[model samples]
Target: MHEPDYGVAGRTAIVTGASQGIGKAIAETLAASGANVVICSRAQERVDPVAEAIDDECEGTALAVECNVREREQVDALVDATVAEFGGVDVLVNNAGGEFVAPFEDISPNGWNAIVDLNLNGTVHCTQVAGEVMRENGGGSIVNLSSVNGQHAAPGESHYGAAKAAIIRLTETLAVEWAPHGIRVNCVAPGLIQTPGVAETLGIDSEQMPEREEVDRRIGHGEEIADLVQFLVSPAASFVTGETVTAKGVPKPGNSMSEGLGLE
Candidate 1:
């Protein structure tokens, strides 16, 4: 009997923002599965250790590249380095983004621009560069990391939410435009994934954390998101494209204020 193959082993994959968190998990997962991985972030110091660790644990190769996705030149350099090291590109994951929590009125124009540039334009840089390599290679998979805020209201994160929502539309458009090139594009929207960095950012002490099931109600692990990314890039999802998979456990309804901005 012929069995199913994920078609990931021996592939070359570039995962941006992979110095830690979900991006690191995804890079590790792909390396362990025998895919040569190029992991990058804004600082070489941040990515070198991750590459070293993956190289030690996985049979496949891992290359560390320093890239600030917001800069198109740096992004192009990153793709060039990946091609030089791995020979070609097969998968690209756009996972670098950050946002600050504040009321819309309190957010400065510069602050809003920073979020949009990092979240939306950063994705554009990586996708366009990597897509070029994919085109030359005949096909590839691109998975973007969005956020649940893109779909729902985030009172304190309006800028980030808007950028992520835009990413969803970009994924759809690219999926269609690149279909002829055999490239697939998709998005993953995660909410409150539990990581050391995230905990520190949110001022949550790890010592007081509950069990996995309890915590998973409101927060998930980076590995959970990594798994979804793997599936999206694997042959199992060959028929899947231009979709946004939300990984925020179960949804719970909430009461809305009487008059924020009525849709009436």
Candidate 2:
């Protein structure tokens, strides 16, 4: 029997915020699968080592670039650098975004704009710049990272939810607009994921959670999201676009109940 091909080999992919967590996993996963990966974060120091490590361990190449997606100049440089290194980009993952917990009334204009700039505007910058290259190259895939809060309520994270929700709409619109260019745009909405940052924020150790049988029922790992992203960008999902894939694991029976509605 012939082995199934995910069809990412020899492709060049750029993943933003790839210094850690879901972004890191996606970069490494793509590199390991024979796709030349360009990993970027706001700091060169954080992403350089990851690039070197991928070079040592993976079958494909890894390049590290420092970029703040909110800035169009830096994002342009990142795309140009990737294109210079690997000819043209075949996949792009907009995975850099953040938000602070605060009530709607407490959210300052600057704070709200900051979150929206990072989550929504940032995606716009990267997609537009990268889409141009992909359009010229005949085809490519673009994946935007969203959050489950965008679908449900996030009391203390209203700004975050709003920004993520905008990303969903942007993904759908871009998918249709770019279809003629063969550029597929999609979004991934991940619920609770077990990562160091999340663990620290929640005052729980994810390292220890796996030792318990509850691991199966607990939050997912960054690798799981990476797996979904891998599929979405690969040939396995050629027919998929303008879609939001939620990787939140199984929902509890009472999640929709009033008593179960609570913020993280």
Models 1 onward score TM values of 0.90, 0.90
Worst 10 residues of 2 by lDDT: 255-264
RMSD of each: 5.3, 4.2
lDDT of 2 by residue, 1-264 (tens): 866558688999999999988899999999999999999999999999999999999999999999999999999999999999999999999998777788999999999999999989998999989989999999999999999889889788999999999999999998999999999999999988877656665566867655554333357888999999999998889899999999987644444532354521
Query: What is residue 222's positional error in candidate 2, in angstroms?
Result: 0.9
Candidate 1, poorest ten consecutive residues by summed lDDT? 252-261
**Which regions in candidate 2 have their CA more than 4 angstroms from the true location?**
1-4, 200-217, 251-264
The regions of model 1 sitting more than 4 angstroms off are 206-218, 251-264
Strongest candidate by lDDT = 2
